[model samples]
Target chain A: MIDTLIWLVALPLASALATQLLPRYATAIVISTAIATSINAAALLYAVATHGVMLYQIGGWTAGLGIALRADGLSALLLMMAAIVLLASSIYASAYFNDNPLRRRFWPLWLLLWCSLNALLLSGDLFNLYVTLELLGLSAVALASLGGKTAALQAALRYLLVGLLGSMLFLAGVTLIYAGYGTLDLATLSRVVAAGPIAWSALALMTVGLLLKTALFPLHFWLPPAHGSAPAPVSAVLSALVVKATFYLVMRLWLDIFSEVVTPQAASIPGVLGAAAVLWGSWQALRAERLKLLAAYSTVAQLGYLFLFFPLLQALPAGAARDAAMGGLVILALTHGLAKSGLFLAIGIIQQRSGHDTIRDLDGTAQRLPATTFAIALSGIALIGLPPSGAFLGKWHLLAAAFSAGQWLWVVVIMIGTLLAAAYTFRVLGHAFGQQPYPRHPVTIAAEEWPALILSAFATIGLGLAGAPVWQLLKVSL
Target chain B: MLTAHWLYGLSGCLIMTFGLRAVLLNDSLLQRIIALNVMGTGVFMILITIAYRGPDAAPDPIPHALVLTGIVVAVSATALALTLIRRLTEEQDND
Candidate 1:
């Protein structure tokens, strides 16, 4: 299991270097790395499922001295989701970047991004988390600008600045944690962190920094352009996995480290912002003129749903109820990661085929591309929380929790957000029924279409039917 | 109560506030980027202050290591931001 953790990071890091050195075989290298990492992620998940939480301390030193890699059920699940999404997207990217000179650079940066995501998820020390966060930010920004367009470059620059600011604030928070507790290890800090000035201030600084990076509500202004303007595969992962990584850190801090320190009122702050994000982001998506822009705005709204879980989880006593709500939150996040990536890859296909992603102009193109359109529809169903989708189950738990907690306002917010999501989703699907003649065949390009189709189907059908294990996995911590 | 530690810590906070203010309010891209770097320096200062001990005592080594790693990250980020700015300027010139 420890070897699994080491290989999870080392494989991608080595592959990234190999791709840089051998650019001609970058595609082949990335494919093999993706397969290898996926296998490792599965092994980690299986090991954790069978043996509970696994911890690896580097150099045989204690937690506070040497870096530690910890994977409980939650991190393992997220790691698996990331591996699955990256593998699917890598397949799409291979075909998407075919015949383009950009593929040479894309492979290295893509692998670096994967390495950072794995490192960040497994990092047990606060300082190590900061380093991984910086790596993730830099690699994401570099990838975002690979489109070489003015919009892409400008958005990538803004993203870099915001990311830097967020990391600086996060580092300051870490400094305070170390100053007060004399330890950078999360487990040690969680045991010692109590309610006080140092704890409160560090919590505030870190949450604000993370919220900025996660782009919650008002801080979300930088996201749409950055995610929308990036090339297809880059946008897919940026929207799917990158933002979620920071949110995962925030969840770790709030629910795990600062569980006793954080007040319900404080938790409500993100909940309220999340409520606003849902309404505002969905509205923006409905009003967005382009396909990619709508998807980006929808991302902002989808993340808001994740934030809504914090308060509910805070209010619920630590019992089966809280565990269920936690499971729902993870499931929703996983569903969004899969569904959003699928939607982006599908849109990428449309963009490549039609040379534009204007929502109104997608009428004939949607019908002409049957498989991609089906992928979009499947993702749209998951996004709207329709039945037999993981999001439906997620939102079901959310509503039940809200009702139990007597939080009527969140219920209202979820209802309105769902309605708005339906409006926007159907708005896109409406294009598929246009007058243009439908393609005779279902699958056009198997390499590209299959990835998106498989991802969307998993979000809707695969996880939806088998989501009970999610709650069980949530129970398997050290 | 009034020691070098308090003074340095307070100054670090003040510097970080100023850099954050400029980064938020300033319109020039280069200025914002520089302001971000300034903010990072303030953070490093705070970390260094945290590492400080009495004149006779050995200081903590963790914050020193964190600061060094942070400096490397900040330098690389600044380089990336500047390269991006140059590219944007080149695009403008072409336009």
Candidate 2:
């Protein structure tokens, strides 16, 4: 299992270097690396399921002294989702960039980004997390600018700056922890972290830094442009996986590491911001002119739903209810990761076929590209939290927890957010039904379309039907 | 008791605040990028301050290691940002 964990990070990194050296075979290298990582991720998931949490220390050192990689059920599930999304996007990207010159550059950076995601998820040290976070940020920014357009460059620059600021703040917080607790390892820190000034201030600094990166409401200004302007595969991963990585760290600190240090009031801070994010982001999505912009803003809103889980979990005591709520959060995150990536790939197809992504101009798209439209509809259903999708189960748990905790405000926020999500999702789908000449064949370009369709179906139908194990997986934490 | 840690820590906080303010408010791209570097330096200073025990004693190596790694990351990020700025300027000039 530990070897599997090591290979999960090593394979992509090695492949990244290989692609850099052998640019001609970059496509083959990327595909093989993707397959290898997916297999490793599956093995890791299986190991976690059978054996519970697994921990690995580097260079035969102790936890407090050496770097550790820990994977419980949560990280494993996220790793699996990331692998699925990346693999699917890789297929889409291979076909999308068939003749494009940028494909060589994309392969190396894409692998580096994957490496960092895996590293960040498995890292058991706070300082190690910071390093991985920086790597993720840099690779993401580089990839975002791959389009070489003015808009893409501008957005990438802004993203790079914001990312730097966030990392600085997070580093300061980590320094404070080192000063107070005398250890950089999460397992050690979690045991030693107490409710006091050092803990409180450090948590505050780190949370704010993470919230900035997560783009929760007010700080979300840089997100739409960055995600919207990036090449489609980049945007899909950025929205689906990159932002969620930081949010995962925040959840780790609040729920797992600093559980004792965080007050309910402090927990509600993110929840309140999350509520605002839900409304504001959804409203922006509703008003966005372009399809990609709408998807980007919808990302902001969907992320808001994840944050809404914090306070509800805080209010619930340590029991089955809290566990169930946490499961809901993970399920929601997984669904969004799959569905949003699918939507982006489908939109990418639209943009490529029509030379633009203006939602207003998407007349008769369904007739022309039935498979892509179906992909959009399936992902849209997942996004709207409708029945048979994992998001529905997630929202059901969220509302139940809110009601049980007597937090009616969050209930109202969730209701409004769902309605707005429905409005925006259907707004895109509504364009599919416009009158135009239908193509003779429904599926054009099966390589590109199938990946999006499979991902969306997985999120909406597969995850929804088989969500029972998610709660069980949540119980297998360290 | 007034100590070296106090002085360095306070100065670090002040510098970080100033850098953050400039980064937030400055319009010039280069200035914002420099301010970000300044902000990173401040955080590194605090980490160094935390590592300092006494003149005679050997300092803790973990924070020092973290600071070094952080410097490398920051330097690369700055390079990336500057490259984007250069390209963007050229693009605007062409326009």
Docking category for candidate 2?
high
lDDT of 1: 0.93
lDDT, residue A320, model 2: 84
Taking the tens digit of each residue's C-alpha lDDT, what string does model 2 give over B1-95? 23998999999999998999999999999999999999989999999998888898898888888889989988898898999999999987887
Clashing pairs in 1: none
lDDT of 2 by residue, A1-478 (tens): 5798888888999999999999999999999999989999999988898899988878889988889899999999999999999999999999999989998889999999999999999999999988998999999999999966788888999999899889888988998898888888998888889989999999988988888888888899999999999999999999999999999999999999999987889889889989999999999999999999999999999999999999999999999888889999999999999999999999999999999999898998999889999999999999999999999999999999998899999999999999999999999989777877788888999989999999999999999999988888778886
Model 2, position A293, has a per-residue lDDT of 96
Clashing pairs in 2: none
DockQ of each: 0.85, 0.86
Q: What are the models' TM-scores?
A: 0.99, 0.99
